[model samples]
Target: MAEQQRLLGGRYLLKEKVGTGGMATVFRAQDQVLNRAVAVKIMLPQYAGDPTFAARFKQEAQAAAALQSPYIVGVYDWGKDGDTYYIVMELLHGTDLKSGVRSHGALDPKKVAQIGSQICGALSIAHKHEIIHRDIKPQNIMVQPDGNIKVMDFGIARAKNSHLTQDNNVLGTAHYVSPEQTRGQELGPTSDIYSLGVVMYECATGRVPFDGDDAISVALKQVNELPVPPSQINANVDGDLERIILKCMEKDPANRFQTADELRQVLNSYLAGRAVDVPEPTRVIAGMAGAGGTEAMRMGDKTQTMVRPTAPGDTASNPVIRPNNQINTSSYDNEKHGMGKGKIAAIAIAIVAFVAIAIFAVSGFLNGGDQKSVPNLLGMGQEAAVASIKSSGFEPGNVNQSYNDQYSEGQVCEQTPDGGKTAAAGSKIDIVISKGPKPIDQVEVPDLSNASDLDEAKKIIENAGLTVGSTTQEANDADEGKIVDQSPKAGEKVDKGSKVDIVVSSGPETDSVPGVVGKTESDATNTLSNAGFSVNVESGGTSDTYAKGYVMKQSPTGTAKKGSTVTIYISEGKDTSSDEVDVDSLGLTGMTAEDAEEAIANAGLKYDPRQQSSSSVEVGNVIKYSPGGKQPAGTVIILYISTGPSE
Candidate 1:
C-alpha cells in the first residue's frame, strides 16, 4: 500500500496519486523551487528490492535523461532516498495515444506520419546513445489536444551493451515488442526502429502488428507473424507508407532499419509532400541464438589477464623482463586506477617493447581522448571568458542577457554546469549576460469609466501602455469618449496586452430650432455654443421689412442636429424715411431712415431731433436739426427761437 501520511521523497510534497500501475505509481507533486507541476513516478518497493530490477529501472530513467528531444517527456531528475526510487517528469495535459486511437477509431495517414515522425526523432536521440526504449506502444504515447505527441514511460527502457535488462523477463507490452526484444536477445537501435514501425502501423490501422488471446500467444506472433496491410483496414493510408510499415514490422531483427533515424527520415519524407520508398534490410538472421545450440559462447572472460601493476619506474621505458620501479604498482591495486597512472607506466622498462608502444598510444585519454570537466571562469568578462571556454575545449552556447541590478553590464550572470559540477569538458557552456534591471514602466490604465470621453482620453490611456476596446455609446450622464470599463481592472498587475473599454459623449441637448426670428446673431451663436452646437452668420440687404442682426432662416429650422451649425440672416437696420426727410443727403450718408429723417450725402452729418414738429427755416434740416450728428453732409443748428444761435 502507498504511504498515506508521507511520501518516499522528502522534497516533493505529494498531494494525491494521479495514476497507478503494476510497476510504479505516479503522484501529482509541487516542485518547490521551480514552482511548476511535475509527475513523480515512484517504483514499488517490491521491484526496488531486486538489484537487477532497480538498476534497469534507474537505467530507464537515465537513458531518458540523456535524450534531448521535444517529443520526449522531459525528465527533470531522479533519486532514491530509501527503498523508493523515483523520477520527476513533465506533467502533460492530454490523454495517452491509446485513448486517442480508441476515440477516433483510426487516424488518417497524414496525421499518423505527423506524430510518427516526431516519435522517431525522439527515439533517434536515444538510439544514438546505444539505448533502446524497450516499451513502445500507444499507451506510452501522449497525444495532446494541440496535436503534438510526447513519448512517455521510459521506465522500462534499457541501454544497449548494459547487463541491466538481462534479468530474463518479458519486459514490454507484448503486442508491440520487437521480435528480438521478445526473445530476450541482444538488441540495438533496430529494436526501437521495429517497435516504432509497429506503433505507426497500429496508428494507421487501429491494430497492432501482432496480437493474440494471451501474452505468450502474442509473444509468439511477434516472432513469427507478418502484419496485415494497413490499407486493408484504413483506406486513407498511403500505399507507400503501408509498405514502409511492413518493412519495419519484419519478424526478423536483421531485416529492420538499423536506426530510428532511418525510419524517421522515410516518414519525414512522406510528411514533406514527397513519395518515400524504404529498401528492405539485406540481412535477416533467424530466431534468437538464446541457449539454442549456437557456438557463440565464450570459453571464459573474452580476453582475461591477471591484475598486477608495474612497480615504481626503474629507468628504461621498456627493459627485458624487469618490472619497472618508476612508480609503485603494488600499492596501486589497493587504490583507484586512472589514465594518468597507465600513461606513466607506458614509459616503464618492460620485458617486451611492443606492449609498451600500445600503452603509449592510449596515454592521452582513458576514454578515447575525451575531456571530463568544464573549466571555471566565473568572474571573467564575456570576451575573455568565451575565449577561455574555447581554449578549455568546450563550446560556448546561448549568451542570454538578463536583468542584473548588482552585476555590471556585459558581465556573466550565470552559467550551466555552475561551478563544481563535472560536465564533459568539451560540452557546451550556456551563460546568461547581465542586462540590468528591466526598464521602469509608465502607468497603464486598468479600470476605465464609461463616463470618460474616449477620443479625448485616448492620448492619456495610450501613453500609459494600456489597451482599449472599440469605442461604444451608453446612456451615461458623463461626456462621451471617456473610459467606461476595463478588463484586468486598474492597479491590477499585467505585463502588456491588457484591453479596456470606454464610452463617449454624443453632443449637446438637441431641440427643433427655437424660433430665433427676434434674436440677434450674438444671441444665436451663444445659444448654439451653450447648447453644444455652433452658429454661422450671414447678412443680406433688407427690404425695409425686418430689423438688422435678427434671425433670418435655419436648415431643418429649429430641428438642427445637436452640435450642427445654424445659419441666421441679420439685418443692418436700414429703412426709407418720410416727413421732410433729406433723401439726397441721407443717400450720400449710406443710411436710410423712415418717418422723420436727417441725412448727409457725403463727408457731412445731419440730425433730426423731432417727430411731427413745426420747423421755421428750412423745415427739412434747419427747422429741427442737430449739428454734425446726422447722416447728411451739412447740418444747421435749428433753435426753436427763430433760427437763433443760442437762447
Candidate 2:
C-alpha cells in the first residue's frame, strides 16, 4: 500500500517518508484527529524484533516526551500498532548543523557561541530531568530558519534510573565521543558537555578535532591525544571563545564545565560582549614515564633525549640515550670503569647544564638579545604604530578594525600587550585600529503599498532590517492577496529589528445570500447574520400562503456585500380584516417588525417606531411592543426595533 493509504493506529495518515536513520524511519504524517502535520518515527523491522531494543525504543519515547523546552524537539505521543512501534514528534523544517557547516565553512565566533548557547539550553533541561544526551554533535543539532537551533535525536539518551546501561561498549560516534565514553565508563551531564565542546570546536574550525581512517583509531585519539586550540586552525576564533570551547572539551569530567547551565551562562556572557572568565584548559602529558625508578631527561633548543636507568634482571628496552652526532657516550663508558658513583653522577649534571647554556647562547645570538618591552600603540596612527613596533625590536602582526568610542578612526585602539609588558624580541605585536563610535541601530520601515503579495511584503520588510509581524485579511477594493495597508508606515524610523504588521486585501466583500422565504422571522435573521449580512425587517401585506411570523418576501437575495443589510418582509397572519382585532389572540409570538406593522394596521391601530442597538435581537427586527391586549381604535403602539449588536 502507498504511504498515503497507510494509516497507523487508525488515526495517523502517513504522507511520505521524510528521513531515515540506522534504527528507525521518519515519515511526514497527518494527524487525523488533530488535523495537523506531525513526524512519525517507526522502528526498522530489524530492531523491532529484538525485545531488548524494542523496550529501549519505547523508553526513548517516554524519556523524550518528559522533556519540555523550546530548544528541544517535542515528542507528542508513542505506541505500538502490532509489531510496529512508532513515535509522533513535531515536524521540523531546516538543515542540520553538520550539513550547514560543510556547505559554509567555519562560522563567525559570535554565531558559534550563539548556537552553542542554545544547545546548552536544551541540555540543561534534559540534565534536570536526569537524562544524559550521550550524543551531542553537529549532526544532532537542527539549525532552524529563524537562526535558532533545536537539539534532536535523543535516541541513545536514557534516564539515570533506567535499567539499561551502555557501559559495556561505546555508543556515540567516535569523532565526538568523550574520553570516559571511549572507556565505556558511566556517563553524566559533563560527558555531554565534552561532546558539545567538540561540536563547537568543529563549528569554529570547520572540522572535528580528531579523525582517522577507522573508528578504533579515532576512539584511541579521544582518550590519549590533546586537541589543538581552535585559534590555531581558524584565526577568527578569539581567545575567550577558545577558552570556553577548550574548557568544555577537558579530558577529565571534573575539569569541564560542571553543568550545561554553567556553560550557557559563560557563552551568554561572551555573546553580550562582557568579559568571560573561563580558566585555561588543563594540559596532560601522556606516556611520559614507565614503571620503576625515575629517568633523567635533558632537552636542548634543537635536540633532546631521555635515558632510562637500567635495572638488574630487567630486559624491557634499551636504557642508553642517543641523538645523531650530538652527544658521545663512548667517553662516559671509558671513564666509568675507574670513576666512583658520585663522580659519574656529578659529570652527568655538568653535561646537562652545559648543553642548556650553549642552546640559550645560540638562541640569543640569532634573535639579537634579551626580552624587550612592548611600545605604547594606543591612539597612534596605523603607520606610526607599525614603525614603532619595528623600532622596538618587534614585528607587526594582524591589524584589525573595530568600533571604539575613545579612539578616532584609523587610530590604534588596542594592542595585545601593555606598553611596559616584556615580550620576547622579534615577537609579533597585534593591534586593533578604530572605526569610530558605533552607529545608531535604527532603520526606515519599508513601503509595502506596492507589494504584490504577502511573500513579497515579507521580503521587503526583512530586507529593511525589520521582521514580519501579524498579518490580517480584510475586504478591500484592491486586488486579492495584495498588501492594502501597513503599520509604522513607510519611511518611518524605528529601532532595527522591529516588527511591521500588514493588512492583506481579500478583494470585494461579496457573498451569496441565502433564501429565507417562508422561514420563521428568528430563523431568517439568524441565517442572514451568520452569512455576514445584517437583517432588516418590514411589515408585509397579509398572505394566506405564509404564517404570521414567517418571511413572505425578501430583497437583494443573491450576492451582496458582507455586513450590508438584507431586507425581509413578514406576513400579517391571514389579514383578519376586523376593525378591532383581539390583541390577545393576534398570534404575534415571533412576529418580525414587518409582521407587527401589518398586524397593527389591520387592527386599525397606529405604531410609533423606536430603534436601539441590541445584543440578543437581530438588526431591523422587533424586540418588544407596548399595549399588548384590548387596544381601542387609533391606539398608538410603541414598536422597539433592533439595530444589531453593539460594538
**Deviation of model 1 at 336, angstroms:** 74
- Candidate 2 total steric clashes: 2
Tens-place lDDT per residue, model 1, 1-647, is: 44534544666666578888768888888776667778888888789898877887788788888876667898988899777888888888889988888888788887787677778877887777877787888888998776778898877777656776465466788888887778878777777777788888888988776766999988876775445567656767755777778778776666666677777767666654446766532222243321221111112233111111222331122222422332222223324656655656665646357675565456535556564456675556899879978987788988888886545677776788775445565689988877755654545454455334555566555656765443334333344344544444567654454434444444334566655666777887786668666677777556366677676555447565566677767776655432233433423221223222422323333434443333333333333334323333244433221222332
> Candidate 2: deviation at residue 143, Å?
1.1
How does each model score on lDDT? Answer: 0.64, 0.83
**Top candidate (lDDT):** 2
What's the C-alpha lDDT at position 616 in model 1?
Answer: 38
The lDDT, on a scale of 0 to 1, for candidate 2 is 0.83
Candidate 1 global lDDT:
0.64
